[model samples]
Target: MGQVERAALETITPYKVEVVQGNFVSKDQIDQLRAGMSRQQVREILGTPLLTDVFHAQRWDYVFTIERQPLAPQRRRMTVFFDDDRFTRLEGDAMPSEQEFVAGLSKPRRNPRQVPLQASEEQLLAAQRDPTEAPPSTRTAPDPAPTRYPPLEP
Candidate 1:
């Protein structure tokens, strides 16, 4: 191979450093997007929505979620409110239906243990002995750690 061809091949190799364009979308661009579009157009661009309204059946909400990735997916939610089979308003935040809210609440969450405060040291020790009783040291944090990290190397 010629010198120029060899150099080109070397530059295009697997281990060669390549410039990658950043995947970034501004908030303005995201805000400009609307929910309602032809099925063909939607499919061509965004594919499908995470969820759709059943009873009301006026809106389709698309949730772009990216997990454990370098760049987070542009969180875009579009709500299309319609009137008499025509698009009326294109918005983001809309009040969830009662069924949706109820379904969300079905998940159980363990309540945190509440420790009592403003009590004497003797009361704290006595309370610690019983599981039901609350401790007295809850009034204030005893030893708070520093907010910043330790000194860095030069």
Candidate 2:
């Protein structure tokens, strides 16, 4: 390849597939874990372990990975160690709150819509009449209707 082609390749970032795999670890799930809790209880809160070693059955690993282009890949690992049948110590990256995690993944709205102001009947009539005047601001403005009718229901 020519020198220019090599330089162009270096400047361009290759596409990477968004990879979301393994267990989705959240703060609420991790909080449910307590010392001396049974392995089944921990499993209920955090779901099935991604890695269960035959050599070390007492420890369970929950791995979460996200791979996206340009941005750095994210990996979260939670290890739950059990002594016999009871849960023991917990270790790994600090889990993010559900709101925080969701917000981080979501992009903010680029263009937001503005709510239109409600116009009174008089204001509407005035607008129709002049087609250029500023809208009336008083709720108690005099009614411009040619005739007012009493409610038949009343």
Candidate 3:
């Protein structure tokens, strides 16, 4: 045996698979999958799923997850949505649904309105002070209107 082959065999760990690599299901394979195929056929071809939604009986999902640990976020998720036991939609960083993709980007979340939490008179006075008077970091604009707490009736 060659030096490289000998080293590979020696360093081979239980977690690592040697010889024939695992097959990766491609878009072509998923496209070729036909509708009305029995559950047995689907299972035989694709193997078991990472997740299965029990809420929807008609839809079946196949998910592939890849975790990349880095300083920045690395998201690699593949979800294939099947309708009537046939592939209808696929979502992932690689392939995104045209219909749902546009809808997702259309709306952006609005900033929540800041409400004055319950505060004593001293706290309220401090907040109303001029921003320039306070330290550079401590400078904060005063609320447009102070919260009015109703006085107790005799």
What RMSD does each model have against the real structure? 22.4, 11.5, 21.8
* Model 2 whole-model lDDT (C-alpha atoms): 0.82
Ranking by lDDT: 2, 3, 1
Local accuracy of candidate 1 as per-residue lDDT tens digits, 60-110: 565433222222332435554555544455566333444653353353433
For candidate 1, give the lDDT.
0.49
CA shift at 131, candidate 3, in angstroms?
A: 77
* Cα TM-score per model: 0.29, 0.58, 0.32
**Residue-wise lDDT of candidate 3 within 1-154, one digit each (tens)?**
9999987785553653222222334454555556566655666766665566788664545544332221122233455566666655555545344454334334233444589779999777778877559564676777688578678995
* lDDT of prediction 3: 0.53
Candidates 1 and 3 compared: the better one by lDDT is 3
Identify the runs in model 2 with alpha carbons over 4 angstroms from their true place. 1-16, 107-154
Q: Per-model C-alpha lDDT, please? A: 0.49, 0.82, 0.53
- What lDDT tens digits, residue by residue, belong to model 2 across residues 1-154? 9999987787665766788989888998887778999988988989999999999889999999876654567789989999998999989999898897766675345336599899999877776865555445633566688787888996
Model 1 CA RMSD to the hidden true structure, in angstroms = 22.4
Model 1 worst lDDT window (10 residues): 17-26
- In candidate 3, which residue pairs clash? none
